[model samples]
Target chain A: MLTLAQAQTIMSAALAHAGTAGFKPLAIAILDSRGAQKLFAAQDGTSLKRGEIALGKAHGAVAMGLGSRALHKVALERPYFVDAATHAVGGSLVPVPGGVLIRDASGALLGAIGISGDTSDNDEAAAVAGIAAAGLVSDTGA
Target chain B: MLTLAQAQTIMSAALAHAGTAGFKPLAIAILDSRGAQKLFAAQDGTSLKRGEIALGKAHGAVAMGLGSRALHKVALERPYFVDAATHAVGGSLVPVPGGVLIRDASGALLGAIGISGDTSDNDEAAAVAGIAAAGLVSDTGA
Candidate 1:
């Protein structure tokens, strides 16, 4: 079973890296395997809208069992499915910046990570740092 | 005015602490002026069940002009009102844990923060770090 401690480590590392770089980041979200919220952080000065974007993106990643970027690939591969899903879910499948799927050492369904601030790539980079710091890795199928 | 930088800081600190102590967690949420979600992070192993709770709590906090704890107090004060609101809004008022209103130095509603992990207090503490780190303070409602 994936522990919350591991998730927290991943998130903290990301935030530290982002600070060092001086990025205009806002929120960070970490979800457990069952798609339940495991950890969350919201710094001051962040834009208000960031919360939803972060949740939607992270939720999408966890539910799909893949990173948002990889999920986006599936969307690209099957636009009809992606469009249908997004419409059906009422703006749930937001393939924007700041979303990624995290796994445990055994490649278990630990949860997902989503960030909102600056660009999508920047947010993703910070998230990656968090995961790496936790001694885990993120995968985005190319 | 709250920026994204603070949000990131708060969440990162929370995760670091949580990880060191060891706990299960959920994604963190950050909202902005319009009560819209702007930033988010999903830990690698958060459960899916807690996702809705985190979102609802934060949403309720932002929708109302009170901290979630204050809203909880009001809920106890007027169960009928909170219940009616819950039913009318499809059970959006989650008063369990991990929700706080974001305010400026002058006590203006900048947005809100929501977390799900460990316990309500644990979640709140993590969010607190992000808020304080971001150079903002949360109105804990005393």
Candidate 2:
């Protein structure tokens, strides 16, 4: 069970990491294991659709049970599969690197975090940092 | 042009109002006038689909240029029109009272806010309170 406190910690730490790294404005989303949204925040200057993009990444990670980094590769190798999966998940699957799965020390899935507004690699790094700060493991599927 | 700060204020106040009024845990969504999501939050214990429902209310409101209260009436009187409008808005239209339009003192549309988890009337009340806290006017389309 990903408690709200843990979700809030992840969000705050993710934004903090982005600020320290001087990344572009970001939108972040956290979804629990069941793919229910837990927390979300979009920076002041984020583009209009960044929130949805961030959410898509996180929701896709949870829905497919794979980090978006892995999904990105699947998208390249099997475009049809990815496309069908996107529709399967109700069009919220964004195959990209910024979505990461959250796990406990026991490797139990807790939730996922997604970030947007910077390069995909940088966004993934921020998510990794946030999960580590919360003493959880991040599975980027790399 | 809803700034992040203002959006945050609305979220916080809306949640606060819900808490004080002893409403159920809620999911809230804010979207800018351009129909872009600005901020979103789902309280602890919110059901899995509450976030989407909240977003649909707000998105539907902005897309239709009317608050969800009006949309609700339309859904009753002109079901086909409401159904078509929902399809037009990428299936994010939820015709209900929980969606309200945000306007400036000058009567300019700014964005919309949606809340779910309580009675639709209570949800609309919370949205109105939040908008007022931000010194904006709320049009429930009553």
Q: Best by TM-score, which number?
A: 2
* Cα displacement (Å) at residue B45, model 2: 2.0
Model 2, A63-135: lDDT tens per residue?
9999999999999999999999999889998999999999999999999999999999999999999999899
For candidate 1, write residues B56-106 as lDDT tens digits: 777777766566777677778998887787777667667654687777678
Tell me how many clashing residue pairs each candidate has: 63, 0
lDDT per residue for candidate 2 within B109-129, as digits (tens), equals: 989999999999999999999
Cα displacement (angstroms), candidate 2, residue A38, comes to 2.1
Ten contiguous residues minimizing lDDT sum, candidate 1 chain A: A33-42
DockQ-based class of model 1: acceptable
In model 2, the Cα lDDT at residue A53 comes to 94
TM-score against native, each model: 0.65, 0.91
